[model samples]
Target: MDTSTWIGIFSVSASAMCMGIGSIAPALSEGKALQQALSSIAQQPDEAGTISRTLFIGLAMIESIAIYCLVVAIVLIFANPFWNHVIAKPGG
Candidate 1:
């Protein structure tokens, strides 16, 4: 295949790999955060509201990492900067 085709394949493969692997840490972090929050709540029932609120905010922050990864993957697969360079070549 040509360079562009190979680039496309590689981009898609890398994007898929990024999304598949990038999500793991955030998932684990969110799970762990929730676990700790629950444990804290159990230990201090009166502070449940504060713990729950902090947990949700922390979860949202953690989730943003995955969202960023997804954005990067989408950009790689659908709007790759290399594609522009390849397409802009005089002989392309």
Candidate 2:
């Protein structure tokens, strides 16, 4: 009913949505990337080392997206900037 309550609800819901949607895309991308890398490696066995190294780096980069989402979710839940704004509002 209050601003703080609304902010809390919004923050939690947003964080949940952030994590849920964020994880799915990265997961799907990782899977697809892995599939492609594996197929490439299979086709060029002699280039396996280079392909594998690049695959790991690519996977790590892709995984950073999910990590960023997780960080955002955590910030929303635990350190919400909106919470300060809501709290500092004039006699809300």
Candidate 3:
């Protein structure tokens, strides 16, 4: 019922939402991107190398969004900025 308790609750819930929603979107995007890349490579065998290279770069960029979400979730769960604000109160 206290400030810290509320902070902990909110932080955990927020982290859960961040990870749950964030991971799904990127995973779907990566899957779609890979599928299209494969289709392109299959259609143009001679350009397989370039297509593969570009796919890797695109995948990395898309994956970065997931990585960022992970960082945010980790921070919310383990090192939430709001925790400091609540804990530093004079009567906390």
Error of 1 at 52 (Å): 1.2
Q: List the residue pairs that clash in candidate 2.
A: none
Cα lDDT listed for each candidate: 0.94, 0.94, 0.94
- lDDT minimum window of 10 residues, candidate 1: 83-92
Residue-by-residue lDDT tens digits, candidate 2, 62-81: 99999999999999988889
Candidate 1's C-alpha runs over 4 A off are 88-91
Give candidate 2's error at residue 41 in angstroms: 1.8
- Give the CA lDDT, 0 to 100, for residue 63 in model 1: 99
TM-score, prediction 2 = 0.85
- Residue 86 in candidate 3, Cα distance off native in Å: 3.3
List all candidate RMSDs to the true structure. 1.6, 2.0, 1.6
Per-candidate TM-score against the hidden true structure:
0.87, 0.85, 0.87
Q: In model 3, which regions exceed 4 Å deviation?
A: 88-91
Error of model 1, residue 74, in angstroms: 0.8
Report the lDDT tens digits of candidate 3 across residue range 32-80. Answer: 9999999999899999999999999999999999999999999997778
